[model samples]
Target: MTDLHFLPGCRIEEITRPDANSLHICAEARRRSGRCPDCGEPSDAVHSRTVRHPADLPCLGREVRLELWLRRLYCRNPACSRRTFVERLPGLIAPRAQRTDRLATAHGRVGVFLGGEAGARMLTQIGMPTSGDTVLRLVRRLPLPRRPAPQVLGVDDWARRKGRTYGTILVDLERHRVVDVLPDRSAATLADWLRGHRGIRTIARDRSTEYARGIGLGAPQAVQVADRWHLLLNLRQMVERWLAGVHGRLRRLPPTVGQPAGPARRTGAFPRSQGERVASADSRERKKALYEEVRRRHAASEPLLTISQRMRLARGTVRKYAQAESFPERAVQAPAHSILDPYLAHLEARLAAGCENARALWRELRDIGFPGTSMQVRRWLGQRRSAPAKTTPRRYREAQPAPVPPDAHAGAPALPSPRQLALYLTRPRDGLTNEERSAIGRLERDPDAAAVAVLVRRFADLVRGSCIGGNAVVRAPIATFKRWLIDAQNSSVSAVATFAAGLQQDAAAVKAALTTPWSSGQTEGQVNKLKLLKRQTFGRAKFDLLRRRVLLAA
Candidate 1:
């Protein structure tokens, strides 16, 4: 209806909605006296009057423009700088700003959250039109907050470029806010920062030796706690290494192509399906023809490149074919198991029964406990719908599908990868999938695997306390960790022993982690946020801008 109010010492003259998307307000400052910024002297003498047009916050989805009339007051005192000055609006628009303080704050906040380009686009759509560069300028102009030294600090490193460069971020653990970001994760840089803020009582960090050394140099009195997650991660890595050492024994080879699938023997070749066999035969026939041609051309003194170009094959392949005494059969690798294995037969049966609509078939399969999405079903349906007339004909309409080999991988499941098995060991028993549960069951049957599992579970309990024998759980974790360390060191598994030795090197931090509630987990989450901001700028931001964004903003 009207321009209700403005600055404390200003009066509104007129309010007009110029268009459907714009609001213009005319206001004037009615100050009794103004102060000269140069000499801090009160002046009532009017040198000249001036009109200021500044942008305000949008009103009712329309852009707001403010035209404020103010006086250019002259300094009265001779002691003050004898010059005219534009009167200031202390709580509204700044002396030289083109927008209200509140509006600039809104732009700056958006810029900090979304960064330049995205913030500018967002501001334009929201009726505060501004350029990306302007938003960035506003963000950089924002003053950094004065934060006191944290009582408990969480320190961690984030890669500026992974495996090449790294930076450090310190967070106030109690307040859960980023305190500052450093250029590098070096001990000296962190030590300098820590020395400056001497009030830190505890420091939570990862098991990096650099950080340990830094903490030692910076604040020796501060209690250093190793992150429990890192401790667990190190154990998993050790488990993987042990698995790697014995991988040959753990891995079962596939049966040779021509041999009937039986107990896994040291077969040199892989199994092939009937279709793969057909495909391989056709491929070999074509290669044999090509090989003959290559040999004939080679005998005629043709260049390898010429032969390759003529045959549309690689020179190496042509040379290889030409060099062979006979056309060698291409080795076939075992076909990987697909997600459609369980539903393949049922899908074939349904297709034979004349259900052709992929969408309907997908819904039917979904009702019968199918886990795959409809897109896979649709694609498979497209292939199967045409495969009937091609691969399968009326002559083989009544023929049954081939039976799976009794003693093959179908009967005895394949072993999981070493990294996968290590994760399975680290994961909670109750949270495992049914297949993972069965896999672990089979793994425990092995004496080596059984011993490793026992040690891993014990170490896990020491770090993350477990309920044992109905409420008689571990209370003194540091003591438990010490005993576990001795047991792990004496274990038959060399990898486990190696892991235990590493814990002994940083026994204080390890013990502190087991006993204390603090961790660098929160700091890790902040690093992820930092990464998001860095990537949003397409990795072009330097350390200074990145530091400002990470520290000054949330």
Candidate 2:
């Protein structure tokens, strides 16, 4: 049966199952002639024969063993240097190999997706048993894909070990697949890689100086587009820094003359009882004391790390304490309605009418949709009874109390964190909720915040492809960006001014980012995927094996 397609050019003389888990096939090369090793001459005289048992792909849950007969042919040419040469069956198996090419290919595929240990376990479970080392060897031996250099390339860095070692990843934007992974993130390495791929017409990357210098050194003619995501991220961080300096603007400010309070101050919950109010007040005091202690230790020039260890607090909390110039006060919020609110008047009326039985009042209210238990009614009455009696004289109480100005901070909302305010400033206005919109309105009370928001929105819109090129030189938005940059450069907020200066330094890349449509988004996505593949090996795989897996697995 020479029809066993896997062993092409070979004939099967006999096939039999030796055990339940395996099958054996007696096979030999069908070729009768072969070329001499040293001289280019064909030979048909068989000089010797040898037997080999090579393993192949599993067949129907059984291991396949082939009894192959390889023949040695005698060189008939008198001028040949070699006496004899073995016939090469390249289509079937490799020289001196213990397994067939088909089996190796299958194992390589398994190794590609699941690294060594996992692949070995999977192969054994699937009845094609093989060791992890063999699987890894097969994967490493695989040939990488061959393709021409891409015109549009994306480049970004990935952390080999975050905040420590890093590497660069290149992607073909058109194919959305990784092209290569460099061991380190450096200008020389990227320059070398880019020089080799001269076909690149556009290179999309982040606003990193190393990458920029590398591109200039290697592919000066290629256009460099800064990543839009990085641009907006930088903007948000600037906004956060500005907010940090002006923390008062992010909170609900005391009402000014004729200015009304915004809806952001609306409360979300209420104290369930008198005891709850007391408990909340006590908790606030405890928090105040702890904050004071943290700030006190920090002001003494103690390292925040030591403070965190002594206090059993997070390092971030310690840093926040050290950074605050004053104790951040929480704003007051109105109490929410409770289930007992509707029944309160009825219970009071009964108590005043000499019907002081709390259980009877609770039962009466239960018929009118009051879902609370009698214990709640009892607690309310007991609290009222336990309150200290007022000692004011009845005659003096009738006199009008001195006129008091309204509490300006009443019903104020708790201040949003700097990061939260930054999100509101950078995110689209259309996506904002009613509370966020109100917060924005409240924040605008500070003229500086209003001016900063205008600049932030303009920058965000430009980066998001909604450029406002009104009265620009060529309606190309480049002029509009320049004008906005000037406005930010002169801004009172140092954070925004600093960021604007950075943009001016990288003017070319920033401008190219606005004009070009390609970005480093694909490159960033590939880096994230690389993290997954790296973690698959528990971070133990060397760079060579990881690179091979990344290339071959693709």
Candidate 3:
């Protein structure tokens, strides 16, 4: 067959169609006479004729098969011990490798897209033949740059095999990239990583004692900042606990006593409000309906507890509700003006009169027939003391004189009214309810709201805090929240208090989100794209090559 020259010193010769699926090539190597093929010594000795063997090579389509014949030679050196040696091939792939280096590389790249076995199928479809393992091997052989440990570190744990094993991921804060993954989430393992890496000025980590211990042992100098996300989560749990407790305590109170207004009484426990009643009523209704259905069987001589067991409702509740024809109506009313209000004016007067004694106020309020308990008065006094200083009214006149009334003059523009300014400050968002709007107006006038506002103001303070120094702004609020949580007792204020606590602790991380914005949006998008690539590859492609393509594409 005639040879086709592809380039200088390289030719494609004798392209035999092995099958519709594979291409076979028989080509001669570039020949140059210098040393004996049998030995490296400069001896010229020609031995047997060429032989043919199967090999793989890069081709346009299908699978390209290479059939090569090379010469054998004898040593011409008189003193040489060797009789013959086969000629060594150049520009060929590793020994025993089925595919050419180029084809193997292509397979690896496609494998990452196809993933494992899927990639193998894809390569077959493309006419570049390969298997999943071949694609994996190709990926493993590729060189990757050795990265140094990061300066500022972030350590997070993920399930290796959920419920059995876990892995720790270490990220470089400065580079905003993953640096390494640890096999275990133990303190010893984490400490080892910290010890191996140097110059880590800070660590953002969860509230695990193991990590804290590790940081203490390995990178003592590095400031360990509680991750804002975890702090918020912890605060959420605290809120849930308090909310549940509040509901439970209210349950023991008389049904007729409605929710108390003003600072809620600690022991003059109020009845459930409409919102709480609705939830409780719904739960009761669900249970009652189940019990009635089950009780019919019970009435027909079924065991007493059997119906309860079948329905999964408490035996006592089932017995009580089963006798009734239907679910009972919810009895809830608007919370009343708290019994603490009568003492509010007196408490404020005492504060105005320079009395900071909470215990003293409790006694004074108790003597005035305050239906509520001492704990309630004490809490109210505490809130009053912490409230901000009231703002004095400021008078201002417009620079321009008021225009004449529109109907009075020949041509006059109307002047803006003071009510507009009042509305702007006091009004809630347009669609807000009357109660919500009133709350806003109260917040505008009262010092208590201002105190709450101070904590709310911490949100913005944290944003500016980042620019001030080396992440000190975040630490301050986190510390404050910790203090509040430790001392918190009143369940009424606990929800908002915990929310404040969460904000304080997580302020830094959330601000980091606002400023740097490390959202999972892009990562999630890539994961979705990866799913497609895997489907295309048919689950046969290698992971290393898939990873390479994903990273390179990024």
Candidate 4:
């Protein structure tokens, strides 16, 4: 209600509410004697019509705003040779700021946290008028002190657009915050960041050749520990890649179409599914049809190999079919009969001897002429256990399991296998419950599950076989797993074959990691968080802001 208030060194002259939500105030500057801020001259002539500002009280339980207006008079001193100057205002604004001090403070704080565009949106929500660019300017204008280099540093690379532009970020691991961002994840840039730190003793980073070189150059004495999460992630990716290679080979074969479902047979070759078998058959049929045209030419007296070369069919495939009894009479040899035949006898002997032991049988086969390693053997055995057992004799029945039933446990397919369970257990399962795990376990163990049950049992055996400090020895189960993966008929064998090559490539590291407590748990969590952030940002992210948010949030 009152316009003026008395103070020791300053006076507030007037106050008025221009609108219900805003206040308007006018005040006079009453400085006794001071040099002009603009002209730097002592004792201004009456610099006419000046308004002073005091820090305003909080408004609507939110922010404070202030305004100041002042004029400069022409300096009347000829010898001093100075123009008119405005009164100096310290603790309020720099030389030229359009908004009041209070508003700028609000923008700075909000921009730093919610970012420019987001801050603008939030400010509107809170009844303040602001723009995204204004908030961004506030961020740029915020005063920050030059910081010293951190001792324990972490380095990582981020892609602006994957495979296009990449940037490197340095974090003070102790502070758990990003300190700086480099133009690229190159040895030169990273090395420069490290060179700035005189006291750096250790750096934690991923296994990047560039980063390693940079660290070596920047801080030769710093010990680099490969980030454990990255280690696990690289390992997992490597394994997945190996599996994909086998998948490529399998794709070349046609899918098995309308093939009779039965207990899967044991073949030393990689197992293919009914779908895969159908695919393989389709491919062969297509090839066969093409070959028929070539064969017609051959029958018409074109050279045998010449027909094959023209059609692009293997000469061997043409020769075998050409020599067959008849087109309808001749059977296509199973994709991998050679691998299966030698081991089939051993499987029968084990089952007959009441051994019921996959590992023993796998070992027996390995001792004979099995081409695949023990892991391959174990995968094959696991598939056999998980697959549906045949009512027919072991010699002829194929190992295809029944379809999954409805009303199965939540987050589990109707026909879940132990291999799937093992896969799920390795990663986070947000939707799966304990009941789901048990249900899957039950499915894996069910006699109806066949080779799938074998898979579950093999997983259990591997878990049990984990030992302390000795050789981390490969037990009979591993050999069985390998055998199952190479087997053609076992349903679970497909998954095993896919995972085998990767496991073999880094078999040593993987075995050690599995045997030890190290895992990809943290890395997977980070990947999930990254996906969420990527979705939230929606491709409009600035590298600086994204990097800041990740480092700070972590």
Candidate 5:
């Protein structure tokens, strides 16, 4: 018979199909003598024989299984500990492994790239029958290669369960690969990891105090650099706080020409009914009482937890009230149900088409199953018509004065919200839209807002490394930043003063952030990747599996 050499050093004896999806390839080892695994001595003395079946890679679009006949050989060396050992094929498979090395490698790659159930489906489509659990096991079994100590490091924490538990990921900033993952974000855990791996020159991190302390304790020689992005983000947050404090001032400012009034202003603070006014007054009194109590407790040096327990409020609510400089106004929620909702779109379409007759619109709605009365439609149409055409440019002829609803009046002049004001203050002038520019102009009308705006622009220029000039650009120096921070601290803006204090606390890191270009931006990107990997496991995977996937896959 012609010998069919299927696998290396093995001959195929027979082939059979146990099922339509699978093919069994029976084979036997060609060598008669086997080596003892422990003693490494050749032995022809066969004590027993057995047949081992292991899965192999798919062949010709069918799942392949190998049935190999193996021998149990007796150890010939008298001094050897083992009396007998199983014959092993080192290149074909590992000891007691269920699959060949080549097949395991393919599964491992699929597991690393696609992850578990998705990988199993992909492998099944390619004629490899395996479960999601098996794919995960293969991935977890892969060995991690030893990496050299990183010269520059980036550290950040990722949530295993957001707001509850987190893990720290340390990356070699130079190579941009994750070096290790610690089980917790605690100072002790991170410090331990850092101590194990030395030779770090610089550590880039966020403004996390725990990480800062850990780095200081573990590697005092390494320079700590604060991330620039976090610094800019802190600036934006401070600006928002400052705006929040002066939001009432923003409302008092007159609206600019061509600026469309917001919904709040359009509904200009209509005179509330007696009952509505009574209810609002009651709500305000209750909130003010709570705010005062929180502030009093905070002034007495009571911690947030003690205040929360004493007041019978959640800690988060207690913290908010304590931190707030003034009692927060109750946010006006929009009416949930409106009679005009169903017909408003049609009315706008008609108005856009120059159809302004309320009676005609009422008749049209009645034909379309509108159950509302003509008077209700007329009142709504009157409000829309009376609203100043800030957005639309078309001219309209005066029509009959439709009766206004008791609840409707000219809204307060439209003004930008605090958030929009903050964006206008921080973003580049070139990026602002015409409306935003107009809003900025309106804000600058207030002397206080204008002073704050100027400081914001100067700080932004210093951070960006350039300043606007009369047809010429100029470089901003670090000295300018130092001077600006001093000015900000002395300024009347409480948010800016608080921000300046923080900069002073970490003066060295902040200065390094400005002078040196190194940053934790790469660490942020790796965190995004880590989020993707965490999601791939459907959030059920433990740390060991997650660590292997991140390190080995990289």
Candidate 6:
């Protein structure tokens, strides 16, 4: 048979099968090394020979092990401090390594792609048995490849231990890869990192004062661009606060003198889970006690902070409780997802076909693949059946048309939450549904809300590169944004005024965000990736490993 040349520059001599899944091959190095590693002088004197066993890539579905016969050479140069050195096996394995170069490379790639435990399992499944720790070590030892400096950088902060410690994530926006991760979110750390890497012409970041200060100090020449998504998000939060303050004004208009009062409003009396009911009752009792104590303290003319200290509650909580109002209700928890979610379409089809019996629906669901109980189906059906039914209005006898009652349409849509309202306001008018349009029209009737809506729409037009008038698309200029900011400030809306002030402080960045297209969206995507890596390791991995995985994987 021909010589086995699986490994170049090495001759395979004896092959032994220790087990059905193992192959041990004894081999000797072919080349005679004569170079002294330290002195760089040629030495051919052989000192001794030794056997080094190192794992190699699997061959033909069997684990391959190489028993390499290596030789030690004496350094012939007397002037060199080194006495003896091991013969180097070029392209095969590194000194003191337990695996061949190619095998280590393969394992490193595996670790980078799948991470520790998952990668270990994958290697074992592929006939290469190795520990997770070994895989991670191999990955850690791999050298990082050099990259050219990016001109456009994106900066953001991610929580290391949320609400306690945070780190900065810098990304090359043009290449869409993370550049580096700083240990802390401090301005000094970020500024130091920025000062090290020059040639950054533009930086896209959020409205973080610390990051802004860092950029100003480190790279004053670089143009800063505020992220549009963050700007819109900030605007939404302001709008929500404004809406919360004026929520009472959003109530339905009172009925006219001759108009008949509508039917008593249907309240949700459906049975809730017992555990949830108990929890909610307990929470309500706690809030009531806290509110009573807060009111008692306020009646005695105690300061907010003093009350908070006495009650061991936050000052904000004390303030909220002290305000003259009834106990605030706890937000209702949304119902959890049921097994019926997969069969919702089928159930809807059956319901449209006049199948209203809960038992029948449950039987049909079980006939397919639903593993849920009949009670869930009953609860769902009860909700559907109990919904307020729409009724036609009776014709009025008066000569002039009677004013329509606020609840004239019995199927009037439920009022949406502030978040939903913000969504409707920010989205294009043409894309809105009939109900959403009606909601917007109702909201516009309030002067404050109307002013905020106008500003929001103008901001949306600027961001989306479209003009607001008659679908005549044109990119909104910085001048229009400035004018809008001035309008918001003068509108007497506290939330809008605060937002406008923030924009004015970062006026240049905000202008660049509107006029220029640079954004920190790519950097945010990288932060998401970092979060995934952190989760994969169960958050036990150190920052070094996480940093390596993020950079190498990218």
Q: Which residue runs of candidate 5 sit more than 4 Å off their true CA positions?
A: 1-6, 46-48, 81-83, 114-118, 257-305, 308-326, 330-355, 358-382, 385-413, 466-476
Query: What TM-score do all the candidates reach, one by one?
Result: 0.74, 0.75, 0.48, 0.50, 0.77, 0.77
Candidate 4 residue-wise lDDT, 1-554, digit = tens: 33222222234566666666656555454566547554466675665765544344345543334445555655655655566666655544445665556567777677666766777898766645579888767666666545667777767766666768877766666555456667688998888877777798766666576787888898888766555455434434433332222322222222222333333354223555678768866886876676467557767888868877887877755654454323321121223344555566567667655654455666777778777655555555554553433334775356554332222334222332222333433344455555445433443343433353354344434433443343344555445545643451344444444444544543433344334332333333444454454445565767655554444334
The alpha-carbon deviation from the true structure for residue 107 of candidate 6, after best TM-score superposition, in angstroms, is: 2.3
Q: What TM value does model 1 have?
A: 0.74
Comparing 1 with 3 on TM-score, the higher-scoring candidate is: 1
Give a tens-digit lDDT track for model 6, residues 1-554: 11433777777878888999978999887775657889988777889988999998887788888899877889988899999987887798888999999899899989987888999999998878899999999999888867899899999999888878888899998888888888788889988888998999999999999999999999899999899888878877777656644644553422123223333323223455557767867987988888898999999999999999978998757865765345544322223445666777787788788777888899999999889899878866755643322331344222232222233324444345556778888888999866567667777777878888998888776766621333232344777887888898887777788888888999988877776667888898999998888788887888898888888877
In model 2, which runs have C-alpha deviations exceeding 4 angstroms? 1-5, 36-41, 75-85, 255-409, 466-474
lDDT at 552 for candidate 4? 36
Question: Number of backbone collisions per candidate, in order?
Answer: 0, 0, 16, 59, 7, 0
- The lDDT per prediction is 0.79, 0.78, 0.52, 0.53, 0.77, 0.77
1 or 2, greater by TM-score? 2
Query: What are the runs in model 4 whose C-alpha is more than 4 Å off?
Result: 1-10, 51-58, 62-81, 125-127, 241-554
Put down candidate 3 lDDT per residue, 291-338, tens digits, no spaces: 567667767887758877877777755654544333422322233467
lDDT top scorer: 1
RMSD (Cα, Å) for all candidates, in order, is 11.0, 8.0, 22.0, 17.9, 7.7, 8.9
Name the lDDT of candidate 4. Answer: 0.53
Residue-level lDDT for 547 in candidate 3:
46
Off by over 4 Å in 1: 1-5, 79-81, 252-410, 466-475
Cα lDDT tens digits for candidate 5, 1-554: 11332476677888888999878999887777888788899998989888889998887788989998878889999999999987887778778988988799899888987899999999999988789999999998788878888989999899999989999988888898989888899888888888887889889998888998999889888889888778777777777666665655565566466665332212323334556767877988998898899899899999999999988998867866776656655434324455557666788789888876778889999999888888767666555664543443454334333333322224322456566678788888999866678778878888878888988877776666632223232324567878998898998877678888988888777776776667888888888888898999888889998988888866
